[model samples]
Target: MGTVEDYLGGLRPEQAHALRRVVELARGLAPDAEEGTSYGMPALLVGGRPLIGVTAAARHLSLFPFSPAVVAAVAPDLEGFSLSKGTIRFTPEAPLPDAVVEQVVRLRRAELGA
Candidate 1:
C-alpha cells in the first residue's frame, strides 16, 4: 500500500479497527509524524524516518517500532505476545495494550532523536 490508510483499508473490518487503535496511539505519541512506509509496511514517519509501522497479516497484526532495542526494552511488559527482533505481533482478539504501545512509541522517538 502507498499509504497507511490504504493498508488499513484493505484489511478485514475487525483487523482494520484493531490496527487503527495502534495507529492512533502512535500518532498521539508523535503528533508531527507523517503517514508513510518503511520496509514496505505502512508506518508513521518522523523527520522522514520510520517511528512505527502497522500491518495486517493472514492471521495476525503487527506493530513495528523500527528498533530491536525498543522491543527488548519493552519485553517485560509484552508477555504472551509474539515478538521478533523488530516486530510485535498480536491478534485482534488479543489487541496490544495501550501502555505497551505508548512505551514502544516513546522509546522509538528517543531512538530516532525526534
Candidate 2:
C-alpha cells in the first residue's frame, strides 16, 4: 500500500488497532523511524532499514520482522501464531502479544544501533 491508511483500509477494526499498536511500539522503540511503504505495505524505516511492516491479508494481519535474528529469537513465543520466515500472522480476533511486540522492536533497535 502507498500509505498506512491505504493498507489499513482493508483491515477490520480489530486488526487495524493491533497493527497500530505494533507500529506505535516500534516507533517508541526507535523514535527516528521514518514512515514509508515497503513490499506494498506500510513500513517503518529505522537506520536505513525497513524495520517492520504490516499487511492486511484476507484472513489475518501479517507482520514482517525485516530481521531474521529477531524472528528466530521469538520463534518459541510465536508457536501458536502463524508465521513464515520473517512474518508473524494473527487474525483480527487474535491480536499480537504486547511483550513480543516490545521485544522485537527493542532487539531490532539494538541490532541496528538505532
Top-lDDT candidate index = 1
C-alpha lDDT score of every prediction, in listed order = 0.93, 0.81
> In model 2, where do residues sit more than 4 Å from their true spots?
none
Which lDDT tens digits does candidate 2 get at residues 1-114?
A: 466666666677888887888888888877899888877668988766888888877788888878878888888987789877788888767888888988988887787777
lDDT (Cα, tens digit) per residue for candidate 1, span 36-95: 998988999999999999988898999999899999999898899999999999999999
Per-residue lDDT, model 1, residue 96, is 93
Q: Least lDDT summed over 10 consecutive residues: which range in candidate 2?
A: 1-10
